[model samples]
Target: MIDIVTVDTPHPYPPRISAFTRPFWEALAEGRLLTTRSVATRALTFPPKPISPADWTTEVEWVELSGSGVLYSHTTIHAAPTAFVGDLPYRVAIIDLDEGIRLATRHIGEIAPVIGAPVDLVAVRHTDAVSFAARSRA
Candidate 1:
């Protein structure tokens, strides 16, 4: 199990959660990643949409992800926008979740990111809410 570290410095921007996205947020708070899947098309939608974003169908079900994936791409930003300047040298990446849904999230851990490297999801606790990051698997 990954430890969800609570940062003294809260995130400047937190997502606005709604009923449609509540399951996802609740699971993340428990260190589990949950999303919605389209029952008809097997398409996955992150952020737990009420309807299938791919087919606009109302037949959606909650699914838990394995939380293992590969880093498709990543880059470190030395210069961030004004709202994020305090957190300098932060890294972000596009991850190919094993379930076939791709998500963009922050990167954590000391390991240098490499393309195709295996990763696992980690929950980071902030003052306002919980967030996720991809940690490199050595």
Candidate 2:
């Protein structure tokens, strides 16, 4: 049986919004992946840039992203964030998606985090969401 850590109580953070990140936040609310596209060169970018960093063009556009990725790096956190009190000692990781974007998020599920492990994005909830789980190797 796989081990599961249950959070009895979870602290909350007041949601904050920013102009460049609005689309991403909104998409997450609707269970959709959101990324940015460079306006000048029409290149795809993650973390949603308002302008193309390469050429300083304001042609950044929002795009949907597939959530498949692989674990790049990870750590077990003993101290939780102030807003995540009950979830102390959680596993956090940097997942490198197939599109070559790397995102930092809490890693979940039964197995321990490992470098180069296959992972997939699963929406846990609206607020507490978007985590990666180690893919089972048969």
RMSD of 1: 1.6
How far does residue 83 in candidate 1 sit from its true spot (Å)?
2.0
lDDT score of residue 94 within candidate 1: 93
Q: Per-residue CA lDDT of candidate 2, range 1-138, in tens?
A: 112233333225534668778777666555567788886677777667877776788867787777777888988888776777666777878888877788887787677767887877654443343222333222
Candidate 2 ranges beyond 4 A from true positions = 1-11, 126-138
Model 1 TM: 0.91
- Model 1 regions more than 4 Å off: 1-3
Which 10-residue window of candidate 1 scores lowest in summed lDDT? 1-10
Each candidate's TM vs. the true structure? 0.91, 0.75
The candidate that achieves the highest TM-score relative to the unseen native structure: 1
For every candidate, C-alpha RMSD to the true structure in Å: 1.6, 5.1
In model 2, what is the error at residue 85, expressed in angstroms? 2.8
How many clashing pairs in candidate 1? Answer: 0
